[model samples]
Target: MIRSIIKNQECFSIVQGLPEPGQDHNLVWLEVHTPTVEEGTILQQRFGIETAKKNSNVVEDGQFLYMRSRLLALDDNGAPHFGGVTFALGEQLVAIICDDANFQSFDIALQRLRRKPANGQSPKAIMRSLLQIANDRADELVDQIAEELEKRAEDISEISDGYNANGMELGVPDLIETMRALNAKEELIALCIETQLSLARTVRYLSSEIDSTNEADLQGLVNELAFDVAGVKEHAYFEHQKVQYLQKSVTNILNIKQNQIVKVFTIITAVFLPPTLVGTFYGMNFAVMPELSWEHGFVYSMGLTLSAAVLPLIYIKRKGWLR
Candidate 1:
């Protein structure tokens, strides 16, 4: 799908013709959505873009190579920012590529550009406009991530409190899974920060290379990108702290559990010590055993066994060991 946004157009106007560099030697803005190598080739033939760029666009592995190349080119130019931005030109039109397909802000900006006086707008102005739109979308995404992190943190806090209050035990697997989730969130936050920083640098390069037609909007976008980076950093910090707290909590729970097991074993050993001693004495089978010679000796032995078992249990209870 190829969509063209003329200056001051509010919505993307899809056209059937492939995006080609216009012959007018003026800046034109277009977005191409090609999902296959064939579609990309068609777009390249129509737009007059280099074959390499077209090949880059046709990546079948879904690795986002186009975005990566844009980042790399920006970096090489000393802008080195992450995120998506593309620029192409012909004799009549210059096109800026933005990945945001459904963002309302970009639509509105495109509309306003259409209404702007055409005598003064340049390709650089169009590029800045696109950059601002991309940055605004990124800011929105960062805000959403922040909200999600807050909600997750609240959930984790509640679960932690419940465990503390009820003496609940989490198995090793559950603890490990929770830790893995925290790590994944942290990595995502870092990626967002890197991308935002790269975008900021791209904005800076655009500012230096272009004329002052849309500098205010470009600078505003840079500020917003910086703010987004800060937000991601803060979220990452919070996630790290949560992970540490969870680790400590799990360690403490395991220690308490171990102590309980040790207590049970100690009680068992204390209760059986006397019976073991009595059994050992009666098991002697020598001729010198008086209990074997008398009929009532067996009854005495049974009484002794009963007393041996019950007495230690009573002692342990009196000492509050059973509790």
Candidate 2:
């Protein structure tokens, strides 16, 4: 689908399809979302812009500045997905190309663009707004992931406290689920970081390409956008570090729990080993054994085996290991 936003004086109007060559509106915006074969052909024939490409970058092509960026979107389940977005910036118009899945990602930019004054409605201004929007979204996502990691840290603390205070065990399955969630958040943070960096680079390039004297205000906007997006990238990196810290904390907690369980089992085995040895000696079928001839031999052997087990327990208790 193709939609056009035309600015006439102080008002902006949305129309279907691209603006005519000699149209009334001087400033135009062509949005090609989920374009069909014929629409792509029209874009190629009219604007000479193609969407078939990979990677994110900015380049100058004759009378237009072409930029391809990877935009991040969230699914219904809040999982992050990246899609390609191509922008063709002409003197008075900008054509944005994106897939249907990422079509709504431009809503914020479009809404904010409508609120700008007539002088601020240029293609370069709109491009700056789009980058700024992406940076803002990245900031929000990073903040959210950080909050989640904080909660997960609290959960680890609770599990640790329960285990130390009351011998309550944390289930392996639960630990695994938490780790999986942290891993997913880590992936999301990485995407946010990458997207922010790309946006910042694009803004910096745009600022450099602009004729500073001709459009001083627009250049300033792009430069400020570069700084903002760079800040957001740093924020994402910090959150990524937090994610790693949480992952290590979870691992340590699980390891400690497992070691404690193994320790208890080792103590149990040690306590019972001497009794097993005593029983094995008395049960041997030796007809000439002196203990078999004595009437009280069976009782004495039982007492000795019981004493062997009790002695180990007493020694362990004194060593403070039982606590």
TM-score of each: 0.55, 0.89
All models: lDDT?
0.52, 0.77
**lDDT for residue 196 in candidate 1, whole number 0-100:** 55
1-323, model 1: which lDDT tens digit per residue? 45554433232343443433452222255555332567567655665543234444222223111222132122223222233445553334545443433222344456656565342255555555655555555455455545656655554554544453356754444445555665655565565555555665555554454334646664554455456545554654555565556556655655655676788998888777888899998887777988878989989988898898899889989998876
**Per-candidate count of clashing residue pairs (backbone under 3 Å):** 14, 0
Candidates in order: C-alpha RMSD to true structure: 8.7, 2.8
* 1-323: candidate 2 lDDT, tens digit per residue: 88787787767777778778676346467777878888878777876767555344776667677787767765567555677677778786777788653545666666676687543467787777777777776777777788888888877776766542356665656677888999998888888887887777677767866889998888887877777888888889999999999899889888987888898999999899999999898778877888777999889888999999999999999999977
Model 1's alpha-carbon lDDT is 0.52
| Candidate 2 whole-model C-alpha lDDT, 0 to 1 | 0.77
